[model samples]
Target: MKTTIAVLGAGSWGSVLASVLVQNGHQVRLWTRHPQQAAELNNQHTNQHYMGDYQYPPQLQTLTNLAAVLKNAEVVLFTVPTPAIRSVAEQVVPILHAQKACPLIVHASKGLEQQTHLRISEILTATIPAPYRQEIVALSGPSHAEEVARKDITLITAASTSLAAAQQVQRLFMNNYFRVYTNTDLIGVELGAAFKNVIALGAGALHGLGYGDDAKAALMTRGLAEISRLGVALGAQPLTFIGLSGVGDLIVTCTSIHSRNWRAGNQLGQGKKLTAVIKDMGMVIEGIKTCQSAYELARAQNIDMPITEAIYHVLYEQADIKQEITALMQREGKSESY
Candidate 1:
């Protein structure tokens, strides 16, 4: 059966997922805020900035009109950066309402809103109007856009309070190379996805600071513990942190050179200023903002996320990376178990 999926952003992940849907025999309409970029994607069949060499499927269409993009769409996948979700949701709802259409809303974005510190789905649920509220689902995992663009084997979890909604996305995105699992723990999945980017920055910083695999491994392991701790504090199932959206995501984001958060951390560890790092990397490094939100959330909830705190300090207060890492290492030792 063919489905019509409206992808709300044309960045790396959005473009790749749109192409994947096209592979699954669906009509995918991808929208970008830039009209010129829309023309480039549709005419050139490539998103040069985000996806370098990967060509888009011809079946995929690019458009600038939001109303047209959402018209008759069965699914709307939000792939924009976290900061943009609220405004986009606010803008798109009236269009959907005008059409009298209700579609499953799936978000692949991973980050907490800055002040509210809400998860991506939480923001969506709050912003999206009531009639379409239960249709929200979160799609998250270790899958990288670059790898998925090449059709590499990738696994992800689709989570919703409504299992039926999660399974709908599971079936929509599943294929031989792309595997999708359904989960009801939306918080764990979204938190795991958001927190790992912070850890990946730590992992990358460790590497950039001339540390060995041992250092990276330790950071990753401890990072997962803290993520699980915070996830549990937020009312997510503890075991969800061990699943694909948790440990699986942590491993990939922390280790992969393809991770923007890791790359940003690497640059910062190499003694680049935060301003320079942000300017040089022409992408939305979610971990930077996510670190702020996570730190705020931890303080508010009395959760101990030491690693996130250290990373947040480095990114925000210009704390020396070496000093932060050293402080982390010298902190009073505790039991290894989360």
Candidate 2:
């Protein structure tokens, strides 16, 4: 009953997921691009950079070489950021041939590829061989890495083409404190996962501006509107965005102090520049890239996402935040039902 999992990316989320797998009695091969970091994990059982204070199970093996890990891994879990996915995929495509028989690919990362506008599962499908593509699945939710790392009760969704794929992840990842749910709506889950970060930044910025609950609630509600609008354009079910991966994730990311996107936006709202906020965070703030991509996507699809548009302009076009807010409030009134 022990699943062998190869988890790529050594960031907080990746390490926490690996730790969870180890707790679930799975043999985990934690992979990072840096061999020295892998050596540290193998020898010290701690990721000094990310999960510094947390101790991992002694049974967890750490490796830098993707081939070595993927060779025997029953499931390959991607924990890298969206931007790094292509290069990582290119590096692993050759060895992936060996996994053609019955491979299970699980993408734990969120965010769509900016250039291709493809989701994580889409990237896996395009890059991985045909046999492995069919097995590509995504695990996402409102669960924060920090909370989940502490063994807090967390819920997530594992979505794939096959119902069996979802069940596989549920079995591999579910622990006493971590619960996994299955969904076949891969498009909705992935899009919801990606867009929530952008909305979180907006929500955080609003919070930093000393907005009241009514304003925050409006931002949150309207943010879901934008997510639903664009998600539907891209083939997601309208109702899916209202589920855990959508509204649930938006609420958590926007309100929680643990959210990197929200934190980054807070500093931005407090008048610090983008570069400075990122420098202080010292980790990937996915919303910055997501804002850029989502803006581009909206324009390409002819979707009207005003909040997304406002944030995009403020971040990229040097538009005044106050003016953008006023513009949003003054937009032509229409029936609430869309």
Candidate 3:
């Protein structure tokens, strides 16, 4: 069955997802705020700035008008950055409220709102009225846009409080190259999605600091511990931390050059300023902001996340990376079984 989908955001992830929808025979209308980006996607069928040399499916239409994109769409997927999710949700509220039937709201963003410390799904639930919303789903995993663009096999989890909603998204995106799984632990899935980025930043810094595999292994392992700790504290299932959105995302983002967060951390490890690293990346490095949010949340929850604390100090306090690492190592040793 063919469905009309409205994809908000025209970046690499958004364009790649819209292309996937088109390939799946859905009517995909991607929304972009920039006129030039919209024109490029509409006329040239390319989003050169994000997905270099990767031509989008011509069936994928790009538009600047949100109303037109949302018109008769059965699903509205948001691929915007974490910071923009709330604002975009606010913008979609009035338009969605006017529709006779509420569309399933799905978000692929993988970070928490900084100040409020709310997950993407929570933000959507708070902003979108109940009458205008059917279900909120989070689509996340280790999948990267570049790899997906190359038709590499990608598996992601579609998490919702409603199993039916998760199954719906699974059917929508599953194909030859893309695979989807359903998980009902919405809290666990969202936390795993958001917190893994913080661990990835630390993993990249370990590489940047000339650490060997032993050190990287230690950072990643302990980082997973921190992720699981904070995640469980926030009502996430313990098992979800070992699944795709948790350890899976951490492995890919920490080890791959394709990750903007890892790349930014590498620059920071090379002694570059955070501002310069972010400016040069030409994209949002979500972990930097997410680290702060996680640090604050961990403190509030009384969860001890030493790795997150170390990375937070390095990124926010301008602490020397080496010094932070030393500080981490010098902390009182405890049994790993804790």
Candidate 3 Cα lDDT to native: 0.91
Ranking of models by TM-score: 3, 1, 2
| Candidate 3 TM-score versus the reference | 0.99
TM-score of 2: 0.96
**Candidate 2 lDDT tens digits, 195-238:** 99998888888888788789889899989988999999999888
Tell me how far the alpha carbon of residue 104 in candidate 1 is from the true structure, in angstroms, after superposition: 0.9
Candidate 3 lDDT over 1-338, as tens digits, reads: 99999999999998999999999999999999999999988888888899978888888889999999999999999999999999999999899878665999999998999789999999999999988888999999999999999999999999999999999999999999999999999999988888888888887888888888998889889999998999999998999989998888888998999999888888888888988998899999899899999999989999999999999998889889999899989999899965
Residue 286's lDDT within candidate 2 is: 87
Query: Lowest lDDT 10-mer window, candidate 3?
Result: 93-102
Model 1 weakest 10-residue run by lDDT: 126-135
Better of 2 and 3 by TM-score: 3
Report the CA-based lDDT of candidate 2 relative to the real structure.
Answer: 0.86
**TM, every model:** 0.98, 0.96, 0.99
**Candidate 1 lDDT for residue 139:** 92
Residue 150, candidate 2: C-alpha displacement in angstroms: 1.2
